[model samples]
Target: MLLRTERQPSAKRSSGRDTTEKPTRGADVMGKGSVLIFEQDKIVRDVVSSTLARAGLEVHPAAELDAALQAFESGKLDAVILGAASAGDGASELIHAASRVSLEVIVLSSSPTIEEAVAFVKAGASDYLAHPARSPELLGRIERILERRRAREDLRSTRQENLKRHGVASLIGSSPAMQRVLNLVDCITDNHDATVLILGESGTGKDLIAKMIHWSGPRAEGPYMNVTCTTLRDTLLESELFGHERGAFTDAKTQKKGLVELADGGTLFLDEIGDMSLAIQSRLLRFLEERAFRRVGGQADLRVNVRVIAATNRNLEEMVARGEFREDLYFRLNVIPIVMPPLRSRKGDVPLLVRHFMNVFHRELHKPVLEIEPALMGQLEAYNWPGNVRELRNLVERAMVLSTTEVLWSVVRRRSRPEAPSEASFRLPPGGVDFDVLEKDLLSQALEAARGHQARAGELLGLNRDQVRYRMLKYGLNSPAPARGGLALRV
Candidate 1:
């Protein structure tokens, strides 16, 4: 029950308005966000409402539980101030109901007890306040709660924006291999703590996959920090990953937080993990296993909630077999594996990728959209993309820059052609060569020369179309050949 205090006499208004009138819904409202004062006692309700209203908050005072619930259900309220007297037998029920909608509920009681407060808090009350609560204290607590809510809303908005920019939707590929990768990403995007290892060759967009996993997942709002393992030596890399205490090393003048520490409640991307030295691999393995690490020369072990997304082009299994990498760490990081296929293996996606890049570059460089030549796609798909998507992106950007006319053409032709093997330079090695290897090399060269035209490739190799096709299948250059007429870029 609330304290029964007499309602103070209304003071005269200088503006000739009635001061005794009750505040109606949506009246005397200001812009600091709305709150409902659900108190049965009119005097207490009016007091709390006036206090909050004076602080620039819109107040909705409800004397009945039904009215309070109706208002709470209909309005965008920052919080609900639930009076125990008004709630009576359904105080806990009301608290739980508000909690289900993520609405903050602050319980007010005349005779506040520790046990009651604990119970209300456990029932999802944001706070439990005593009757005749100090105006400043009540206002302070409400303001703090509102501030936290605003911060969370802001973080959620940011995460949504990042998802739009770096999510799996941004990964453009329709080939079967790319579909597999997308399927895997969808499965793991909501998983917050798994260790993911992305395996692919350089320029295959391994880093892009890492970003997609971070920004599209539950950890989107967390800090995403990436470091290339090959960029630093073992000693410096250790300090960068696990921080250091002051005077830990010659350059450690002050205490520093490493990428792992800084990425707490987020993600840490370790690029080129295969290049990491064996010594550093040991420390990394321990950190992965324990989720704890000590700073250099620091005795205290610090723990962080960070998801480690590691990527590498090197074969970790072979490295482990050769003792260059820790087998334990490989197993730990490989918990969830995503292998990005090389572009040549998925040449069907080349046209789609080319168009995506063209749109991207047009917006970035503010260049007019250039018409693509029909033959360009054929040439692009025919060549073995040693640098993968990154190479393709660069080629598109370069072509857009150098192309003066509206129609994009002949950029592939400008690439330095392989010089023909001359009789003077051709030498049979003293040890002799593998015939299959020589034949495969010649077949690959002829295919490149013909831009993947079977008959044309046969002309270069002095073999018929069927012979060239058979050799191509044997050498695993199994990309479909262009039609006899020509190849056109398809969507």
Candidate 2:
């Protein structure tokens, strides 16, 4: 007959077994997720419970089926370990019950067999462990399960945060041109499979719109991958988009999954798609048409569900006319077209954007809030922002960094009289100059003038920081390290 004893403070078991063994290293790091042990054998149940309890798990041990089910239903559990002998005929039923609630279940059997393991696994058991379960193995499996649960929780939390951060409400514009873009986004947020093409000049927030669609849409929980087509050449870009098998090329050492495969059930934002070579364009078109693609060296046509969103500052229609871009691919991507209005065209929104960015910079830089000068606001609104919203944002950040008082008087006074150079300022040489050399020389001089500050260098030219960096990289010009105790401005 079994005798039940009251729970003790020490590691002494009611089954007369000593469970006072020291827990292995890293055992206490098993996290706070709870585990349920359902075992009929009093000795096994007591031992397993003690092991897990020592490992820092909130373990609930039960000798009866009814008691186990009661505890499982009453509390939240990350995993449930069942003894096959104790469960007997009800093993499958219990597995189904736990699985229905999405709980991880592991079956423990004394006389293990492939048939029984397969049956239990088919019945929704996460794993099967042989009898006399070793403490290390048991704890290792439980730790892995808890680790996966934690990762999934983290992903869910991130998805919720992205939804909040990139939602339609964060778009921050109500002008008629922006209203039209918002309406299009609202209509397509529910359509997860449609291809979207965003067209706008550089720095017009095309990337922002793509993110808004992904984070606010039905597939918000899935991954969002952004690839700049201009950054890679044809062969490299092809392998990047379609993956490659081992020995596919000189540098192909191991099998790799591409962005398209990793972005399965999600969105893949291809920026600067106009720069993609014809070879890559052909492959991309085929994937769009068939929803399947072969890896660089693999013969299998793997399929994935990915929403392609292509954005470019260049005019694809003109490129098609010039045979620079594929007409078929352009049509496929332009199914749901979105044209972002230039910031100059929406000059009425300048005041709103200025104030919004000022607040954003205030919080980011931890600076005291400064009142916007009326004259500065007038100058900003009247000026043509060739670099669009990005330039405006950079200007605000720069001004905030340079401000010393509660008012933006000094920066406003300096900005009021803009000294923009005209086209006539640059004279063409009698012998036409090498454009690349001229560009590199100008970039070098600007960097020197700004004291190696990329953003300030960009301000000297009409380019944004990213454009400056890209050109600098193209010209193999490395920026100098920032000096200590220098003003830290946003890039």
TM-score of each candidate structure, all chains considered together: 0.76, 0.74
Best by TM-score: 1
lDDT of candidate 2 at residue 98, scale 0 to 100: 88
Mind sharing the TM-score for model 2? 0.74
lDDT of 1 by residue, 1-491 (tens): 22222233455657876554332322223356788888989998998988788777878898877777788677588888988767887787777767777788888788777777777777788787787776656776777778777888998998888888889999989999999999999999899899999998777889999999999888888899999897798899999999999999998999999999999999999998987888899899889999999998999999999999999978899988989888889999999999999898999999899889889989988887667667666777776666678777877888778655322344355333666679646566666666776677677767777888886777565454645765786678786433333222222
Deviation of model 1 at 359, angstroms: 2.8
Error of 2 at 396 (Å): 1.3
Error of 2 at 397 (Å): 1.2
Tens digit of per-residue lDDT, candidate 2, span 63-153? 8878878876775889999998899887877787787777888888887777888788888888888867667777878888888888888
Q: For candidate 2, give the lDDT of residue 61.
A: 87
